[model samples]
Target: MRWLVNHKQRLIITVVFYFVVLLLISMRKNSMYKYSTETYTMYNISSSLVVSDPTGTFRAKLPVSHAFINSVYYYPTSKSLGENAIAFTMAIDHHSNNMGHHTFNVLGYNSTNMIKSVATAQTEGISRCQYTTMMARTNTLSRLEKIEIESNGVSVEVPFKLARYTAPKPVIICISPQFAAEQWQLFVMHVHAANRFGGHLHIYLTSIIESYFELMKEYERQGYITLDYWLRMKFANPRTPYFEPNQNVEWRNQAGAQTDCLLQYKEAAEYIAFFDMDDILFPRDFPTYLEEFNAVLHANPGKNYLFYGRREHEFVKASTLSEFSFTELVQSLRSSQTVKRGKVVVRPEAYNSTWIHNSKHVSFATSVQVSSPTLVHVQLPVDKNGKRNHSRDLWKIEFGPLIEKIREDDIKAIEEDIYR
Candidate 1:
């Protein structure tokens, strides 16, 4: 009894240590139980689809009938508070008539922790044969992470990174896929004129011949152009009836590609102009499109989109088709009796969706048509029959001899190619 009394303090300490260990074990077991259950349920219930980065940047593709996640944009709700939110653009197959309600599950994790969040997507615009543009929004204040989207028994995963909150420059130009790889000269002219106007150009190509691909890559390396390639599916039997025909798929894919470009550079560009390879927007009053755009914005600050009208021009019969300069060609052409539809320049902050030639789902209001002579459309001259009709009115406009910048080697190479 006396010995027991002497060691009483030590006995109490031993008992307390055992109790503490038991409590920690119980807590850890419970945590593991919950985690295992949740993870198991997620894995068992969800179907996993393949994810691909179309742009090798902020865009991802989901298998929702070959749907695409165009752009993932991140911005803080309040700069002072540091709370963040994410907005993304999505493009689905136009033939999908019954989208019903769509939602996205964002599973965010780096290397250690994972968090799952859900956001309901809202449809912004739908082009039946082209694409359907939708926007998904999450106001969850968290770090940007990977995205997982599940629809109709399929799920896709993609890495998500935050884009700049604002663009450093006022204007960036985005061009849809130019499948016609032989038109290298026209493409160069488009790039040169855009750069000359203090605008950056981003081109998305669906499929290009090997030579054009190499040329674009060289241009990309030179910091003059940002180019992205999309791999199209090839069928064993071209005549076989598929769920979505190639033509229909191409149309939607092109629209999605355009949206992807818009979303990719939305933060880095205040205004995005959607132009085709064979088209250019010539500003009559100002030295560059940037200046003209700024004037239009000043006049219509509340407007979210500016739509320009176009005048079509055809090639002259006198010029030899084999060897031609785009600049000389434009000067020789005259306007066609039939007017061509124009293109659009949209404020990224105010518009969430865009078409090939127009902006849709504007946040503010409808687009305003800028007056003529301010924004002129210079269409590429096409040779129809033996007579060419190019617009003579736009000849007075000076675009600073942009064709002179085209490399002689490039012209010769394109001319020599059989594809032309």
Candidate 2:
């Protein structure tokens, strides 16, 4: 303390302070966990409440950087875009920074040298993010071994694996970001439903409450679905302590993740269906989902999207899949169909991006194409304030050999996780 009071010591201390501050700023790239402690003055934590210190992270820089690419892939959309293409997944940014100017350059290289490249097309001022595509000539991407994209100067490179213009699976299922999702029963039910429909589900895994990581891993091993972490945003400065209204918008920003999923499966999966866990796009008259989609396409030619009107109802969740009853679920549906909200099945190549209910852009290729068929939506999740949402009278379903198709072993595969 006496040394600091001296002018020479004071000068030395000032230089050391700024040197340490600059050092910390430079080391921001490598982040470690944030440690914190809480002492309850009112009650003893050991007796009254359980205290668990999560391996939490430091307050990440809001809007990490310009053009944060969630993912990147080579999409040979020659048949759809009339050329070869490389799709850069959505770049989510802060609402303020999203409006800033952005420049993108996409480069492709073979083993030896840089072969070809293109300027990636970026969206204008959007809400939170903008997805871009780099276009090339027909069948030219087959030789590229590496792909790199530069966004406003920051660049990221990925090892490229060239895929054909076509995808193998006819149907791919996608849902928006799953944040703090703890309903293992609902998750198992969704997986069973997708597998039953012959679809591979893809999800942007933001957060899960308990043993779902293990649960998701098992499903991944069984080839039922794919889950990957997204850089989900957080409300740095929130107005309310609950942050209910702005939480999903700030944290999940599901539209960006959904768009990323759509782009990833656009060429890999012949048909992409965006569904929530509770929504069921069951085949009414046909035996399978593909058959039903094809039938609708044949009936309404030139239409690419099939949007089903949905019926809402309260779904009672069971502990096991064996105990779950689709018959009971159907009997609980509201008699009248919902007007604006419904799930949609689409030809992935048909749209550029999607919203919560529908695509961002309106076209003949969207929900307007088919109108007769509908899906059953189960709204079991309560409101933000934890209130039960009621439904109307019940309606009948075709049932149509679906019960017979249920495999007991497959049901048991997912049901095993519920109790664990």
Tens digit per residue, CA lDDT, model 2, 1-420: 112333432211111110000000111233222212422122223232112223222122322222334455565444465445666544333331332334355667667666445443434223432222112122235456776655444455644434344443578777766755656656766776666667677866655543556777888887788875655332223211111111323334565566667766666777888787666555656656788788888778778888876655444455544665544433333433343467678877786566666665647354544455555555453332435435322333222212222334444543453333
Off by over 4 Å in 1: 1-83, 89-97, 110-116, 123-127, 130-133, 151-154, 164-169, 233-247, 250-252, 316-327, 363-365, 374-420
Model 1 pairs in collision: 49-155, 167-267, 167-268, 314-389, 315-388, 333-390, 334-390, 334-391, 335-390, 335-391
Q: Model 2: which ten-residue window has the lowest total lDDT?
A: 16-25
| lDDT for residue 174 in candidate 2, whole number 0-100 | 79
Model 2 clashing-pair count: 0
Residues 308-345, candidate 1: write the lDDT tens digits.
76655444332333454544445544543343567788
Which ten contiguous residues of candidate 1 have the minimum total lDDT? Answer: 16-25
User: Residue 147's C-alpha lDDT in candidate 1?
Assistant: 54
Best by TM-score: 1
